[model samples]
Target: MVSIGTAEIISTHDAYHSSNWPALKPSEKKEMEKRRRIGSKPPTCEKKCYGCEPCEAIQVPTISSRPHLSHYSNYKPEGWRCHCAP
Candidate 1:
């Protein structure tokens, strides 16, 4: 079984500009990295795809961030560089 509620969301795409956001201190960065690496199984069925399973899971590894979708595939990350938290 996998749990999806772990990290707190800090910002959104519209608000996430590197210069304006608060920088992650080394300790905070370390903690976030630990949280990001904690592994879990994938969701049985993705929110974006009613029937399709998620194909990948990667960590964005910049402070504490979720996957960014460059293109829409049921609103989930598709191919490379997709940092999808399980």
Candidate 2:
């Protein structure tokens, strides 16, 4: 997980999908490490809404770093987990 401004989002690379995942910047990586090490609240944690049309329709504002560097997405505050089962 990494903290971008105010929101802390999960950062992952699915090797099964592609091997070209971008690498994190040294500074950003360091900051993410610090947050993970500190075990902070992630600044935001919301319930995982599944099959809720309205909830899915509401998109909170977000900021994205360069796709060539950081590939962060699907930021669930802290406790929320994807309800989608495999």
Candidate 3:
């Protein structure tokens, strides 16, 4: 069975504007990247259809220094990058 809870999903769109999102500390970045390299790739995003609720909400209440999103789907799109953990 495919697992969906390991990694936090993020969009390339949001990633590009690093300023909007808080920066990860050097150690945090290193660890996240390292885990990503060793684990599976992040999930792609899927947009909700007209009149449909979002597949999943993408933000959650968090107090961690590192920024995070609530949900992301595997809807393939060009020029987007995703990250997943094992």
Candidate 4:
């Protein structure tokens, strides 16, 4: 036995499906596709750390040569570290 709430939900769902929605224009569709493609790809870093440290005490390299830790979006020479780095 279907409940009143279930029946209302089913009717609403059917109405929504039956409703006419405006189709995207060719330009809008192309823009959306372009955005999706751009958004899906990873960002490239402009500058990379060679061998610098924020502080002399912190002898460890700010950016590791390791492939995993190599990519940095906001790498500041002054900070000597990536803003996103943990």
Residue 18 in candidate 3, Cα distance off native in Å: 4.3
Determine which window of 10 residues in candidate 3 has minimal summed lDDT: 77-86
Q: Candidate 1: deviation at residue 14, Å?
A: 13
Extract clashing residue pairs from model 2: 45-77
Stretches > 4 Å off in candidate 2: 1-19, 38-86
- Angstrom error of the Cα, residue 25, model 4: value is 0.5
**What 10-residue stretch in candidate 4 is worst by lDDT?**
52-61
Q: What is the lDDT of residue 42 in candidate 4?
A: 29
Report the error of model 4 at residue 45, Å: 16
Clashing pairs in 3: 42-83, 42-84, 44-73, 44-74, 58-70, 58-71, 59-70
Please give the lDDT score for candidate 4.
0.46
Question: How high a TM-score does candidate 2 get?
Answer: 0.23
lDDT (Cα, tens digit) per residue for candidate 4, span 14-82 = 665677967679998899778867322323323433343322221133444565654654452222222
Model 2, global lDDT? 0.48
Q: lDDT per model, in order?
A: 0.48, 0.48, 0.47, 0.46
Clash count for candidate 4 is: 0
What's the TM-score of each model vs. the native?
Answer: 0.25, 0.23, 0.25, 0.24
